[model samples]
Target chain A: MRGVVLHAAGDVRVEERDDPRIELPTDAIIWVAAACVCGSDLWPYRGINEVTDPTPMGHEYVGVVEEVGADVRTVAPGDFVVGSFMASDGTCEICQAGYQSRCAHVEPVGRSGTQAEHARIPWADGTLVVTPGMPDADLIPSLLAASDVLGTGWFAAVAAQAGPGKTVAVVGDGAVGLLGILAARELGAERIIAMSRHEPRQALAREFGATDVVVERGDEGVERIKELTGGYGAHGVIEAVGTQEAMQQAIRSTRPGGHVGFVGVSHDVSLTGQELFYATVSLLGGPAPVRHYLPDLIDRIWSRKINPGKVFDLTLPLSDAAEGYAAMDERRAIKTLLTV
Target chain B: MRGVVLHAAGDVRVEERDDPRIELPTDAIIWVAAACVCGSDLWPYRGINEVTDPTPMGHEYVGVVEEVGADVRTVAPGDFVVGSFMASDGTCEICQAGYQSRCAHVEPVGRSGTQAEHARIPWADGTLVVTPGMPDADLIPSLLAASDVLGTGWFAAVAAQAGPGKTVAVVGDGAVGLLGILAARELGAERIIAMSRHEPRQALAREFGATDVVVERGDEGVERIKELTGGYGAHGVIEAVGTQEAMQQAIRSTRPGGHVGFVGVSHDVSLTGQELFYATVSLLGGPAPVRHYLPDLIDRIWSRKINPGKVFDLTLPLSDAAEGYAAMDERRAIKTLLTV
Candidate 1:
């Protein structure tokens, strides 16, 4: 099987690898139809996160079940499924409370590297959500997005408490941020503000339901959000960038008693207790409970009510995985979908 | 008028001060009936928070209205009232959403020194909640407690989402933390854990509805809480000490998807983003919006349903304000109630 591996900084390659097989009774083997690079993947690829050794890459995928372990009851061979980046037992108290990403037995599905010809999924029944039926070819990207980004964006919106009468501000312009604008709109937010400096990303933000766009960053971005919301700041702010600046902007852009839902993967961010205390905003963030929302996301994609797949501005054959990583890392593409 | 003044870190004196009068059309002058020393007061008294000038000392007060400016509509002379530490216009969006402490026109009511014979309260109509009627002398302390500690603890419990079937843990043994246990009980929490090492404070905690008492601090305290909650940590944790250790303990003692409501005045605490991100707990804190819960708190005190005033284990005449401060600073008293 061919899989993507990261050897070092700026070194992503597609190479032959041993195929994955069910290692547990709760596992299922799937033939990946598509996979994509994630914003988080850039952490190690850019050397921001150290790459100590060659590692399996990619955590997002939509695939057809190729085989199932004896105890895997819900999904069988020939079924199309979408699974969250993290595998959960789905029965723990945390998972039941919709925080499956932090389940007691949670495991990162990327361990087997979904960007391959075939991948093994653990806790199959709990981790994979089958679509209503076999999805059409064109709907594949949208369903694939549901495996992570769409669900993550939706979680950010929900965590931000974006709903009718709310003014929601999004602080990132990546695929997740763009999709967060869509989630906010779908959640009935009265206004959606997308903070983006790039023209292409801003255009996609608008197309995805951003009612306003602010071409600013940091303090200036927060100021613009406050100016737009009558000096009170937005009622809810989504932080999709994990840097300290983005986190501060998200926290500062929310009104007192409002919510700041951050889904960014944190990096060297330290928050002063005095500032957080005085801000008086409710904060809830972490690895989003993507598994909890997979079913609904797939339903939305299947119904064509949302087209999250539009985020895939470039696509490549699995053999040219390095090019896909370069395109996204250099901002040449919003996201790159690779056909397996 | 006479008031308590902090001349230096360890120097407190009862000194003559100018009488307070309405400085704004929205102000009301009150003849303070009672005032109490607070845990936060120790911050400056012990020099954790610098004291540059001779600062007037208390914020909690129960008093009889003396006079009101033309615009003070709700409160009038001769009425007995309880006012929050922070005065708010109550008409701003933040106040309307029940975050009066962060109102657009918020002002600290302690500016006139409530420990004095008379104090001027701004936004009188919004800040003072008139009791059902002038209560007997015995209830004065409880009413004064509602003006700050009781209301603050209530806010923290509410923020922590303490409710039926939830396991609530309180991280401080101060008046606010003790009252938080009471608040959690009132909010229907099934199990309440009070983290305190002092025998006297632990006794008071159990009386205030703490079902379990963990004497350990910091990491050990969190470990004890986890062990008590089937290793999942508590569902709600109240952080009433603003230091980094207390904050970390509170965050660490809460289960994933739980809430941490902090109300201690933050000093030099800082939280690492990666730690908080991984904790996956909802956080809401600040100077509590005490005014929002004033009415209910006052009613409870008035009806003798809760005896939060019991926290004031020592009593002193207003003239002995210095001794009151000393007793609290030396940990000789849980709280000191000064009669005017």
Candidate 2:
């Protein structure tokens, strides 16, 4: 099987690797139909995260099961499925509480490299959510989005309590942030503000139901949100950027007692307890429990009620995965989907 | 008028100050019936927070309105009232959203000290919640507690989402932590775990309805909570101490999808962003919007439903406000009430 691997910092290579097989009783081997490079993957690719050895890359994917473990009950061979980025037993107390990312028996999907032609997934019976059938070729990207980013944005919107009669502000221009704007609108937010200085992203935000676009930078950006919110700040803020500035902006742009759903993978940032305490904003985020929303998101996508797959503007063959990573890393593409 | 003043760190004095008069059309001069030293006050008194000028000492109080400016409508002369430490216009969106502490026109109760014979409360009509009548003499301390501590504790419990079927763990053994135990019980928490090493505080915690006690120190304390909760952690955690260790303990003691309500005035603590990202806990805190809960807390106190005033172990005449501050600073008293 061919898969992408990080030999070291800034060194992502697609090379032939040994095929993966069911190693655990609850595992299933899936023929990767689609996979993509995630924003978090850029952490090591950009040398911000230290990589000591060659490591498997990619976690997001939608595929057909090639084989299932003996104990697998829900999914069988040839079934189309979408699994969360993080694998969970789905029976643990944490998973039962709808936080599968924090499941005690959790495993990262990248352990078997979803970027490969075929991948082995743990906790097959619990982790994989099967679609009604093999989705039409045109619906592939949308169903694939449900595997991670769409579900993540939806979770963020829910965590931030974005809903009817509430004003929501999104603080990132990434695919997830764009989808967050869509999620907020779908969740019935009265007003949606997308803070993006970039033109392309801003246009997509508008297309995704952002009622207003603010191009201001930093504290001035927060001031703009306050002005838009009648000086009380947005009722909900979605922080999809992990920088300290983005976190502070999210906190400062939200009204006291409002919620901030920050799905960013916080990189090299720390919060001073005093300022956050003084802000009096509620903080809720983490690697989202994508599995929690997978079923509903798949249904929504399959029925053509929402099109989150628009996030992937560029698609490449699995062999060209490196180009996909470059385009996204350089901000030339919102996201890139690789066809297997 | 006489008031307590912090001349500098470790120096408290009772000195005659100019009498407070109505400063705004919305102001009301209250003849304080009872006032107390708060745990937050100890921060500057102990030099953890730098004290420069002679800062007037108290914020919590229950009193009778002696005079009111022309625009003060809800509160009038001769009315007994319980007001929050923060004076808010109460008409702002934030206030309407139940976060009065962050009201657009918020005024902190300061300088015209509640420890004095008279204190000028700004935005009187909105800040003060008048009781049905003059409170019973025995309820003065409880009424004063509701003005800040009890209300704050209740807000913490409410923010943590404590209710039936949830396990609540309280960190910090101060008066607020003890009151948080009471608040959790009132909120119908099925199991209350009080983390306290002090015998006196533990006793008070048990009296306040803590179903279990964990005396284990620091990290071990979190372990104990997890062990007790079947390794999933408590459903809610109240962080009453603002230190980094206590904050981390509260986060670690809560389940992955649980909430942490922290009311501790943060000192020099900082949270590494990556760590909190992994914890996946929802955090809500700050100077609690006490005014939002003041009305209900006062009613409960007036009806003798809760005895939060027991937190005040020492009482002194208003003229001896210096001793009240000194007792609290010296840790000789849990809280000190100054009677005018």
- CA-lDDT, candidates in order: 0.93, 0.90
Please name the candidate that would achieve the greatest TM-score relative to the true structure: 1
The DockQ of each candidate is 0.88, 0.89
Candidate 1 clashes between residue pairs 3 or more apart in a chain or in different chains: none
Q: For model 1, how does the per-residue alpha-carbon lDDT over A1-340 read when each residue is reduced to its tens digit?
A: 8999999999998899999988999999999999999999999999999999899999999999999999888998999999999999888999998999998899899988998899999899889998888889999999989888999899999999999999999999999999999999999999999999999999999999999999888888889998999899999999998999999999999999999999999999999999999999999999889999988888788889999999999999999999999999999999999999
Which run of 10 residues does model 1 chain B get worst, by summed lDDT?
B109-118
**Candidate with the greatest lDDT versus the true structure:** 1
**Residue-by-residue lDDT tens digits, candidate 1, B114-158:** 887889999999899999998999899899999899999999999
Give lDDT tens digits, candidate 2, residues B158-214.
Answer: 988999999999999888998999999999999999999888888989999999999
Q: Estimate each model's TM-score.
A: 0.99, 0.98
Give the lDDT of residue B52 in candidate 2.
Answer: 78
